[model samples]
Target: MADDPRPAARRRRPLRAATIGTYALLTALALVYVFPFVVSLANSFKTDEDAANNPVSLIPQSFTTAAYQQLFQTDLPLWLGNTVVVTVLVTAGRVLFDSMAGYALSRLPFRGRNAVYAGLVAVMAVPGVVLLIPKFLVIKEFGMYDTYAGMVIPMLADAAGVFIMRNFFESVSPSIEEAAKIDGAGVFRRFWSVVLPMSRSALITLFILSFQASWNELPQMIISTQSPSLFTLTKGTAQLASGALSAGSQFPVKLAAATLMTIPVAVLFFVFQRRIMNTTAGGTKE
Candidate 1:
């Protein structure tokens, strides 16, 4: 019997239509998500009045870099430098401490391990806002207020990062670790030489998230430091947004700062996007 080409065509017609519709929907969502950044970039090139008057428009009547110049004139550079330092340190610390803690939880057998894991889950459930005063008091008690230690120490170990790494470590084959043990690799050596290297995807994902969170962190910086020299980009931008430096809205200047601050996060996301996608897909499959 001859195959029915007409019926196959009909079946493919609906599938193709659904695919097109899905792509159209995704493109629209992408545009919706992207329009604000586009508007911000356009407004950053416009004069104050131009930005205010044409807030949604992408074209500028008079393009200028005066906003950037003004930002550079202020302590924005210092704020950026401070933010870079804090983000780098916090990210590195989270990666190291969280990965180690996660490895311990997932691989090491100890008394009260389940209790510790439960406590971490509970801590993750707690709202960060609830910890503001407690964190502040601890920082003050330790004489860390308005200092880099206050800014960096509290963020070193994230509960979520530990949970993520632990789950990933559990998914890894236990046979590898058994072989390493037979070869006389100690715990730390086994983690560093075998387990950690295999967890690169998870690490990169953690790195991106930690970097982004610490980079855009505002509340912790607010509670931890008051000195202008210690101000991060988020704190400085908030001040700029509040019309502290200028009497008027000065949208261009504020947006310019925001745009600059966004660059590092954007770059990091793009660079690791492939690894992120693969990890997510692998997790979903598991």
Candidate 2:
């Protein structure tokens, strides 16, 4: 018996068409997403006149590092340092505090646990942007203005972080915690050694989130500090964008600052990216 070419051809036709359509759609989106970064990276090395004149050009009309040089001459370094400090502290604090509070809410049979969890849900509903003025008021009232403690302590714990941790803990099996509890382990000991270890995936997810949030945070920085020396990367970048200190004619400097500020986050996202993605999204196939 001879193979039927017609049926085989018919079977492959739909598959081939679907594959082609998927590739086409993906290619269009890739171009849309990557084109801007490509343009920004190219323009960063361009001279001010070149950047302005050839805004859309992938190639620089005149290549120069003067913009980068001038950024170093300004308060760029200080801003970068401030941003790093705050991001590190906030990420660490959120991971520890959120996890502890969450474990208590999820595992510990404490008084008013239900009410406390409900209160956190309510707090999370209140938008962060709307709290800027209110946060400033409290910070000033506590006389924590213009200090490192002020900038960090107020944001040390977030309601959303707690809620996320609580949800993640709930998703975990309670038997493991119960086993540890029956094994003569105290609450902190069981949580620190057993429960938290089991929650590595969730913790990594929270750490990445906290780092990104504190790093990109602009409004919080604005409300927290008034001194020029206390400015974070985002704060300083905005000031530069609005023609602060430097020659307004030059844009390479601003673009360079933007590009450099993006490096740490880009590196973070690249490293441990799979773990971060899987943890936040529940699960993914390789």
Candidate 3:
């Protein structure tokens, strides 16, 4: 039997080797990916001296929550307020406007549709960094500078989100839309009640993506406002990098600020993560 099992043995040898190599590579990559966040968490609890002394330790010799305490007591609350305002306005506006525009581009019979889409693509191609100064200048010209409106409006209409939505709308069967029309449903009614409800998965995916993008956005904040009270978490965190918050080294406060900034997006990711995964899986299946 051993001599007769040569083909099976050869197959098993290659499979075993491939499996072992995959696990080894994945384990090494996981550690590499996780090490920085681990260090940040550990170092956040360390005193400046301890952080300096043991830069590489994951375990704190003495744990401290002072950084968090100080964070709550300082500009963190204000930054949190600003971030909430900007993110909510940006996400809501993007979802409503982007979807509407995308739907029109995909389904509605209208003139200049292709031109509009081409324009959006062109807008998307314009690198964001290049827009920093120009966006500021426009905000100033529009008298929106240093205002929440300035911060929220420029980012509300992202072309990428519109493109994502446009593709999704196009992917849906046209037969259902024709049926709705036959039932005497108006354009708005069909879209509002029928199509949108069917697009729950795509909408959720867009929501999660827009929330993450707007929440983590840093440069927009820097360019839009100068007042301390208007500063978002990203702006405040950038300030924390200057070492002005602490008498000497304030890594804890900075880390705590970053942690606080991370929480809302973290919560959002957790809540809607399955929808995101499902959307990706569905795309792969197609």
Q: Judged by lDDT, which candidate is best?
A: 1
The per-prediction CA RMSD against the true structure, in angstroms, equals 2.1, 3.2, 2.8
CA displacement after TM-score superposition, residue 269 of candidate 2 (Å): 0.8
Off by over 4 Å in 1: 277-286
Q: Which ranges in model 2 have alpha carbons more than 4 Å from their true place?
A: 1-9, 277-286
Q: Which of candidates 1 and 2 is the stronger one according to TM-score?
A: 1
State candidate 1's TM-score. 0.95
Candidate 1: count the clashes: 0
Could you give the candidate ranking by TM-score, starting with the highest? 1, 2, 3
Tens-digit per-residue lDDT, 108-227, candidate 1: 999999999999999999999999999999999999999999999999989999999988888877777778899999999989988887888899989999999999999999999999
lDDT of 3: 0.84
Q: Candidate 3, 72: how far from true, in Å?
A: 1.8
lDDT, candidate 1, residue 144?
99
Best by TM-score: 1
Local accuracy of candidate 3 as per-residue lDDT tens digits, 223-274: 9999999999898889988765757677767776777777788788888877
**How many angstroms is residue 29 displaced in model 3 relative to the true structure, after the best TM-score fit?**
2.2
- Each candidate's number of clashing pairs is 0, 0, 0
